[model samples]
Target: MTGHQKTAFVTGASTGFGAAIARRFAADGARVVAAARRIDKLAALAEEFGPTVLPLQLDVRDRAAVAAAVDGLPAEFADVDVLVNNAGLAKGLSPAQQADLDDWDQMVDTNCKGLVYCARALLPGMVARGRGHVINLGSIAANYPYPGGNVYGATKAFVRQFSLNLRADLHGTGVRVTCVEPGLAGGTEFSVVRFQGDQDKADAVYSGVQPLTADDVAESVHWAAAQPAHVNINIIELTPVAQSFAPLRVHRDTD
Candidate 1:
């Protein structure tokens, strides 16, 4: 889909969708700069892909660090034609009143503020060059709220709106923005993290059901970025065939 090669930067590239997307981009002849907090994992990915991938350790939640990483990009991977804002996480799944405040803060920091920092740092170059793609990872929770998805869902909604606003702001700049929202994705540490390392609990989230995989999400990102220069895919929402909207909850009282 990429013609004549391009430089792509993917955050949270240590595993899951981010890593998959980075690999796919490299296979398609794009130079990839993979960023994640896990240097070992990122190094493994870089080694696996040989010279096409450049691994850089980063935590998206750190604004100064994120800026430093981008500013320090090696010459070969300096011109990032595509930026995948994929470094996000979900915390405790308790109801709002019972939810952990730390969890809520973490979600907001990483998903909303972290995204803004990356976009702020990279957008000037994209807009000035008049060519770029920023693909933000969102969630189905942004579209349909579920109990326990409180802060996580809210953060994704911020991402969705942010993408739309970016489009308006970049009207004639030839820079593109998109929000990819996925539901019921498996083969990732998302649930494990959310459940605080309870493997069994994490496993149950996708048990007895077929769900989307990281590769599926990666493919969607690749497809959107692969579109013609004149084409812009605003938002793409995806879910596994086995998943659908749930009926609204209602409480009954007997006299």
Candidate 2:
């Protein structure tokens, strides 16, 4: 509220949507706290954006560590005006029957639990200050389920509901919440992570047509966050023009 340039805390910021969002915030004159599990990738923040970028090595799945990081934010970056919950991933495109339990657990922990942990740690401050925005990165899978979208889609569904619920609970608190859902995003580690390092499989997801880039999603985050203090953008669902939904699957017996 004082002389502090709007401070934004961004998770999963080492690459992809996280990094792109961090860059956008910094470009718009906001002091950005970029947190991720990869410290080496985070170093690129200082190289690219100089001192305004506070790189913090974080794994949101670790509740204790997440709490410690938020509680220990430096005096300069303590007053967070915006929180971008972007640390999420989808593992393996196999059907539920063939899915790995470990993959399901990891996705649940990171996509759902990790998000809650960060929000629980930071929302109190936002409510106390009576001015803050929480922007969550959801996915279209939340609405339109596919064969292999199982746990990943469920996690995003949680995000969608959580954002709406937060808005409801913070009715008179001057706080805003938004969920940005993207589909078929390209040029990021998402597919790579999802495919478990299979570059060929990852590339195949976007081989035929161009898909939304991390910057595009970042732009959406920026636009929502840049709204007037009195305005709140609820949910922004985006996908490339080349993408769309298909009819429900119905298998008929050939007997």
Return the TM-score for each candidate structure.
Answer: 0.98, 0.98
Residue by residue across 1-255, what tens digits does model 1's lDDT show? Answer: 434678999998999999999998988889999999998998777777898899898889999998998899888888889999999999999999999999999999999998999999899988888899999999998989999999999999999999999999999999999999999999999999999999999999998999999999999999999999999999999999999988999989977
lDDT assessment of candidate 2: 0.94
Q: Per-residue lDDT for 163-237 in model 2, tens only?
A: 999999999999999999999999899989998999998888888889999999999999998888999999999
Candidate 1 ranges beyond 4 A from true positions: 1-3
Error of 1 at 47 (Å): 1.2
Model 2: CA > 4 A from native: 1-4
Q: What value does the lDDT take at residue 47 in candidate 1? A: 79
lDDT of each: 0.93, 0.94
Q: Candidate 1 — what's its lDDT?
A: 0.93
Q: After superposition, how far is residue 72 of candidate 1 from its true place, in Å?
A: 0.8
